[model samples]
Target: MKQAAQAREVDVLVVGAGVAGLSAATAAAWSGKSVVLIEKSDTIGGTAAIANGSIWIPNNDPAIANGFTCDLESQVRFILSECWDGFDESQKWCGVSKETFLRVDRYVKSGLRVARDLTNTRVQTFTQLDKIFKRYFFSTKDSVDSVRQALGPNHSRSDDELAKAACSSWDYHWENKFNKVPYGKHIWAAFDLRLAGKFFFSGFRKHLWHIVQNMVSIRSLSSLADQIPNLFTKFWGFGSGLILVERFRKHLDRQKVPILKRHELVAVATNGDRVTSVDVQTADRQTLTWKIRDALIIASGCFSHQLTGDGVQDSYSVKSSCVAPGNDGDAIRILKNADVQVNQNPRPVLAQTVIQLAKEKNAISHEPVFYFYGDSFFLVDRHGRRVMNEKLTYHDRAQHHVGNAEQEFLFLVCDRRFKERYWGLGIAVPFDQKHMIVGNNESTLHEEIDRELRDNDCDFRLADNFSANLRETKIAFNEFARTGDDREFGRGKNAFDVLGYMKPDRDHDAPSRSMQPLAGEELYACIYGLSTFGTHGGLVCDEDSRVLNSAGDPWNNLYAVGTCAASFLNGHYPSHGMSIGTGMVFGYLAGLHATSNTKRL
Candidate 1:
């Protein structure tokens, strides 16, 4: 490891190379401040590199060609009125600066402009389905009762309960029945509800219901309904992040920002309420201390077992999904050790569930679904007896079934129908099952599975007898579609249970209607051991991106961003693009603030 004899000085030292860190470094360097960015991984992208890369800039964004007549106050009011019920009263009225609002607006405009330019030039495609969906389906009342009644009474909750929850004060008008509780709160609620002998009720139902309703609503938005698929592809399909990251990276490179990869922060040298220097370890085990004369920004990320190799550490643990493996809680610990005031209030609104299963050869032959950031993964038996909810944050999901010592194995049951519709059976494939030789390296699918099993302390078993399970799962799904009862697990058994609350509003009369048109007989199941997404919890910081001491004051020369910084979304993991947006916006704020402070000095 090489050591510098003379101390290096920088305007800012950004820890972590994820979205937040990159954003901060980019902004700071662009602002004419010398900056140093460090990352534990050799790669600079962090989890965002693998992310779907959608930033949820609601209401009017740059995507709209004709400028809207709406003002920021009006727009903010409209959004708050629609989504406010889920927020605390204080947060509901908390006004965002006009500058911040405009920045977001400009970002939206830039994003849309890039999309349009790319699309016109055939680099990419852009679609505005949300507008289209709103235009066609302007109905404000979101009711699943019709769907429930069509399914059957046994599969669903009483119309009265559904209406009560839907119409209650808790319902945010725009979000419909979706509650504002943080993700952590929701997961804890699920665990508590389950322990109390509750069935058919869980947060998973609410989340899925929200997605279904949103999808249906988005579909009804415009006359361009025919183009909806293309729009969705533009937003969620692979390589979506390429445009955004590429544009941003270019901008930073032009500004001469220094991005240091594969470096981890070990300690902070502080001078009473301010950070003076940061000690970092590189991939090669070399340690370097960089002195910051102006400010230090921390965007490390939340602490999690997978990310930090540390177990659950707080009440917020329930809501955290796994993040990148390199995300340790060092950022938070360092700040806390410096006596920064942090928000330790229990987040009780977040909820999580995971499912685990294996794909048959037909389902995934070309592209395998990569699990990143610990989103939910569900493994359902033929009867949809959820074998696992793999998407939830690690601790909460693991605790659900870890106690069952006899549960040595779980199943991921899939049929020919599932394979045919979602992904072509011939092209979709898991990385573990492919046989290929590339760059002088030869590998086989079976070897990959064996290695994975061995590393995770488990074994994989293929089942040939999936016919019975498929029939049972199909029958249950049919029942659910027709009656909304979820007879197998009582999907909507309780009003407060997160899952139960999301019971599909079915048409009770159509109890025998099949949800899927494909046959289940040809499906197969693969069993594998489970793993976590990463970890959550990091250094606590305010919206300005300044690292806060335990006393709640900003560490004068320190700031944090990205997963390393405490999240603004709290516990709820919104759509794919939400976090990236948060990282970008906050990072920008931190950079601007840090640079301004530097100028003052």
Candidate 2:
């Protein structure tokens, strides 16, 4: 045990350089407070960098600028339909509690305001998807198929093109019964269309209305051509997440704030309820102490890495995570160690279904399978029974797996045709053979699947009535293929479901573009696990983002934002960038509130 170094005082100390931490640092700096931003890793962007970088800001600036409006009550109502269960006083909205309702309301308003602020300050910019398509048009002479083939897998597409591929419409949950305003809330990082003119033509050739309609037609046709896989771009692509981080980093650089890397929070010292100082370990394991003059904002993200701890060991276990390393429940552990009470979400993980592929014969790696590219495949339980709408959003589908106790594991059973045509486990597109259990025939596939299940160390096994159940499942799937309607789960019943099935053919014989006849030979199956990009549970906090103690009181000069604080969403993920959006919103609030008070003597 080395002795701790001398204490250095700072007006503000922000843990984690992820989106939330960056936002906090930016806001604190804007407030004219001396700030120290520290990250456990060498890189800056946390999970945001690894994701699509779209932020689901209801009533966002771009939408408002385009003459779209979503009232506060409607926004709150839409959220209630997505996440909450009970009704409020009016009995029309999700009425969890007054406090909960108010919190949700605050989140909506704050998220909108933050988007506007970021845009105005040029710290971060956003663009609507409809406008992105209208601004850029591909040549009709080349045809969508020819262009896609000409530009191979490694083809360079602008960030905006990538966004268009990922999200053609913001109508993800329009099918949900309680949604009032669904189309305008979804937004992505803005790019200069002027710079992206090469891939798609620069100027609008036809009338404004005609060009817009033509763009829509082209988008639909492009979708038919399978021009894009979900949430992916070719080569070392320039994603929106990178764009978002770069802008934030530029702002921090301009502010002259120092973002110290390789600093891991080890010990936090508290004077009663207030955090007075924190001890951080350097790369060489040297401990350095920093005294907090104003506030300590923890935005280090969730505990996807930390397997066992006070708030973690007993809660639900996450099967897999794509979150950046260093999110090892450091904040929760340190806070609990210092006698602070952390809030625990019963269902904490933001769910995403993943498959564990064999990196080596003995080593396994997780690959996210958020969407099944074609309609030819179906998912089933150990008993060979369909459990969910295979077309549901990753969060929704993964939630089913997380909460379902009877189904130990689900298998994505697809034919060779389906496998060859589109992607499975999207991030690692072109699924490796090692990632799947392949069989030449039905009997072999069944045997291999059962063998894989029996060998699973993650408490998964074949059901008692596996053989009988599988035959019935196959019969049902065939019936679904014939009718083009998944009567049991409503698989292809929504706008989102239609978007996921890249048609890629003007004249196909299949009844539904989302579904096709299964190939007779060479089938594949991969075990799906309950996965998450990050968790949303942490210390409970107020609207100001101040952490609260056991008796429900704010700890002076201490704050938690992003995944460091309990998520206001409760357990719902409304759209693409909810985590990043809410994180920045609360982080901004935390930074401003934390700096409002004068420094302690």
Candidate 3:
């Protein structure tokens, strides 16, 4: 006998409790509608909880209200530059004219208008946030100095090399926001959107502690003076998503909204391009059918790990993504089944830290997804050659790792001094050294080599397929110690990297702007494998986040947001938190749009 699905009804059904889904559900509830928010994971927040939680909303109202400069034209140009890859002017919108079609500029404008009106409270929190965040860039001493050297008082602002060389060290985009609809395509690198509210909403205390602890060395005196006053007026949570989640979740609760966690969305019941209901299998294996009375909003995340099947393997297999496992392609599958077109969009190279587990396992019990290892770190291939610019952006580094032949295993070499400071830098938040190789600093090189005689066949111990790597690593260590540079690989050249970051090293002249340890710090190396942050692929949707059919018409009331839908940048990573920002804005739009259907009836 086939068991029957227990039927229920809701004004709005939101799948996924990630930042996007929560934003959507919250928006709908705010519209005076009953909303249901669900997550496949046991807990809320999704990957956003573990993430650094930086949301990049350019030209945001908070930034504007605070007198922060914004270069919207530059941001839009950069966003659309990559989008023009497969674009055909003759069929720019495929019969949807530029005036009526969701042009990227207009699309952004609409989202900004909605964001300003939809979440005024969230916007207020970021005012203090921008003040705290602005200091983080100025604290780094070297890159700013480099910018002065590269761009003299007379040089043109359009120098690309100077921008790359500057390593995005300064807040240069604020130089003149009043400038014309900027012709610059790479200006996003210079702008700080100031919308990364998680740092303010939650990480403020930890950040203050971090700043206070490092005050004598690298912290900014002025930033501390400017920000301390604001702290007395506000209370914050642990991070960006949690505080908002607490707020949104509470609002939903008061509105009689039921949030079903441990419920996996299984199938969508559609009728003539409209979603009629959603079938979800609960943690108890009970199938519950949510009959949509008004509209269905799919805020499920990207097709990153979690669920597996035929289609997902294609994108995720090429490069693995790092996010909560709950982001299976449920929304992608549902919409595809309804005759919607899904693009398996290819993105530019994104860098991610490829860590090799000691147990040859997939996950670490306390993995630090956001923080990078320190100034002493550098990656080496099997041949013991350095990888290019070890400190480039995580996605940039990850892209290089994907293309590298020696990506299966690379040595993550660090000195004892750098190792000692790992926890402070958030290398692994709530740091745990459960699977580390600690070389002896007190003993001689020969004596230390003797201690590794009984080494296991772990990747770290025998990285080059040798019986043991003590001899190979010891030689490299000595060379790096004496030179204070990786001459073979030019390792510390990126301004974005901690190693390359210029500190006031009065001890050595250091021929270039990059930094390195004085040597003899003792080796603490680990083998790492290439990893990804997440994949950007899924069903196609229009400006309002409405699911579009093959003929380019909206699918009645079905909508897709977050990772479940393709990124607005066409899978390309535009800046630091573009993914989260776009998802939230679109999710906000979807919820508002879905609820408007009720008003029409």
Candidate 4:
């Protein structure tokens, strides 16, 4: 338990090492300010390190570097649609007009500069970025328009909602063609492009415009070949957030930034509305205070019960989260202690429903049974019925699972093949069967079930027999095996459902034929425990990344980013990497303001 004995001084003090804090520390340091970043956990990257790490910056320089245009107006309209009925436009950067908002020279360009710094990419060619980001884009105009027609004008579902349907439907491949518009910023752009309808549609529409803008004579590659380069630049080369955050940390390391892990923010000394300094508590309970001359940025993430019991765990969830071990609500509590109106009682999302296997091969049961995207499995609840699409995006699945009445008691009904296919969390090889509860007839199932669960020592509830009290369960399995149709939950009906497919050219809408009955009339079941992604919500901040007090006054010299701040998407977890994206853009926003002669705190 090492400790910092001397009080330090930094121009910008960043708390939390997740994407938000990491980005802030880097930006402010690069902006000619002395910076110190501290993390409560022993590790630097917070929940972000273990995350998928994709970020969405709509209408970035990549769209225009190759003559691709994004509809700024359309982007604005789509973002506003996230609120469902209406949204406060004034909260959007002081209600900047669409014309003023598209000044990528300010937002997108600067944000990309921040991104380039984080990713360590010298690759600046548009074609190169397009190629790299190809997987991130998928156009959905036809699908959205078709659904829009079906719903008619009476439905009034915004393009954003329609895009959600298309993305979740998994019926189409958008190819990363985000809109030519550069408008939407907060609620819509608040998410990565894939989550919102307008971005997909804009990508769809803009791809056409981009193609024409390129002046192609006949859709010929030769026409564009003259502009395409060797296609790659120097990067940290880690695609997941784990690598990105680490790379950013490396940049901080190069800059001599003091990133103290295992040092948690204990208190803030403020004079009037300005933060004067922050006190940090180390592993051995040694308190070291750092004087903040300019500003203090709070990028500490929202609460997760994995390491600290800071945030409210959903009643239907387990305490463990997939994020870094220290995602307890440090930012929430500290701000609230300062009389800040933090968003209260936030909902927690999970990375995936995870179950720990025997840490040792021959060890007895250690944890819950996990459900994977293998072909031969389906989830059933206490009612022996499916509860959701089962194949929607992970966030949507987490949302649905959290809402289930039998949320705490889901079971993965699978054949032996499925079990063999899914060995453990993130594991492909087979695990020791000692952890599994195997049985023959209906009697053996129920009779040995409780004993096996207890022996395994996990928090899962597996029923005894397949055919005993589960008439509907048996029927659903039989039907799934026969027609490959999850008639109960409509499984495998959309692109999101085909997540198990492992090919470049996959019909995302196709079901893996793994649901068939076993050859020897064998069936099995395990308790599929629902896992949480992470927590969302905290003190709310204005568009400038300034923390707002209970009376709606900005707390001078204090800013919040990442999950430590409330989502402006009207409380909806819309897309992938949004938690990181919002944290990033706003972290960049905080850095710019913190370094400015005009302090916006």
TM-score of 2: 0.80
Task: Order the candidates by TM-score, highest first.
Answer: 2, 3, 4, 1
Per-residue CA lDDT of candidate 1, range 391-423, in tens? Answer: 232223344333343333343433332222122
Error of 1 at 535 (Å): 5.1
Please write out the lDDT profile of model 4 over residues 202-315, one tens digit for every residue. 333633443343333224343244223311111111234555565677777777778888888989988888899888899899888788888989987876553222233445
Tell me each candidate's TM-score: 0.56, 0.80, 0.72, 0.69
List the lowest-lDDT window of 10 residues for candidate 4: 230-239
Q: Which is the leading candidate under TM-score?
A: 2
- Residue 290 alpha-carbon offset, candidate 4, angstroms: 2.6
lDDT of 2 at 124: 79
Which candidate number has the best lDDT?
2
| True-structure Cα RMSD, model 1 | 14.2
| Model 3 per-residue lDDT tens digits across residues 1-601 | 1111223777788888887887787778766766778888888777666554555655555545433334664555445554446443356552333422363554456545655554554421332243333333222445444454434466454444343334432221222233222111111111122433544534445446543443333234543443355342222212554444455566566666677889888888888987888888889998887788778888877765532222333332232345676665677666555778687653422333324332233432213223443454555565444555555545555554453454544555565444444432224212233334545442232233223322433232233433234345446544653565656555444333432232322334444343345246456654444444555667777877787788888888888888777665654554555666666667777887888832321
* Model 4 C-alpha lDDT versus the unseen true structure: 0.52
2 versus 4: better lDDT goes to: 2
Candidates 1 and 4 compared: the better one by lDDT is 4
Candidate 2, residues 1-601, lDDT tens digits: the string is: 1111223778899999999899888888776768888898989988776565777777777777655565777777777766666655476325565445766777787787777777788897788766433222221221233223322456465544433333333445554544544456767777644323321231122123432332343324444344333222311123566667778888988887888888888888888988888888888888888888889999988876653212344333455566676676778878776555676653454444343442122222234565565666788887778888877777777766554555535788886555544443342223344456787765677788777665654556766676567667777886777787778887655545554333322234656535565746567777765556766677777767777777777789888888877776666777666788778777887787788731210
Indicate the worst ten consecutive residues by lDDT in candidate 1: 182-191
State the C-alpha lDDT per candidate.
0.42, 0.64, 0.52, 0.52
